[model samples]
Target: MSMLEPQAPDLRVQKWIGADGESTGPLKLSDLGSGPKILFAFQHWCRGCHVHGFPTLQRLHSALSPRGVGFAVIQTVFEGADENTFEKLRVNQLEYALPVAFGHDEPLVGATLPTFMEDYRTRGTPWFSIIDAGGRIVFSDFHLDADRIVKDLELV
Candidate 1:
């Protein structure tokens, strides 16, 4: 299946603990205020995710966050690892303060690896979903482009 087109209302994400061990909401789409919310879904083991996605995410975070945009990275994983394992995931490599959430701690309700693969219909890492402050998805892609993203978000 291909990526689902942006739908109505807001995507109801599951809440989870951030890399800092802070409890947060399901990355709610409506909480983005009048700005944009960029969600980066990826895994630590994904080489592309680390090499390309994370850095780009960091750039986006640094560029858009001060502009009232909510940037977050959701670390999708099948394993329920401990803090040590998560800490070793190298979240700091992003070089920004973007929060990271794991599926191990906050499994997507009614969604698994196979299911997500079938749902989002992507066979890669760094899947992105950008929701506008009005609780509507304006963009969704599997790759990152810092300048383009900022421009698309109207931050620049």
Candidate 2:
């Protein structure tokens, strides 16, 4: 998941938080359009996600969306389902005041990590991935250089 090599991981979401900040029901990877999409994975209880990741995501959205870049937030609950419940999506939307879609991604039965972490080889929360217009990952990592990503979005 480096800038030189990006993977096309599936976007399997158990539920989506709509623009109105309400449940939109189950969704699949294909539901997201062919896009230059910025997907940030987070956990409600992660300190880094709260202090850094979410703010970066919000900033990126504010800066890049006018250029036609798509954005989404996925709460990948590898642990603490009680803490990272679906309600948090709405809470996050309201708290952040962002109207973009947010998702709930829980682990499959008998699995420990959620699908995003397992399928994308993500290390933990606060992970970010950028998908090209063709749906290929262009950047996937814990750190996001907003200037570089904004520059890269032009090519997509």
lDDT of 2: 0.82
TM-score of 1: 0.67
- Evaluate residue 57 in candidate 1 and report its C-alpha lDDT on the 0 to 100 scale: 84
- Candidate 1: segments with Cα more than 4 A from true spot: 1-5, 8-15, 78-96, 99-123
Tens digits of per-residue lDDT for model 1 on 28-127?
4445456677777666666777688878887887778788887655555544334324444344433445554433222356856533344444455677
Question: Which residues of candidate 2, in runs, are more than 4 Å off?
Answer: 1-7, 28-31
Structural similarity to truth (TM-score) of each candidate:
0.67, 0.88
User: Which 10-residue span in candidate 2 carries the lowest summed lDDT?
Assistant: 26-35
Best prediction by TM-score: 2
lDDT of each: 0.59, 0.82
Return the lDDT, model 1, position 127. 79
lDDT per residue as tens, model 2, 110-142: 988888888778888899988787767777789
Model 1 alpha-carbon miss at residue 35, Å: 1.8
**Best of the candidates, lDDT:** 2
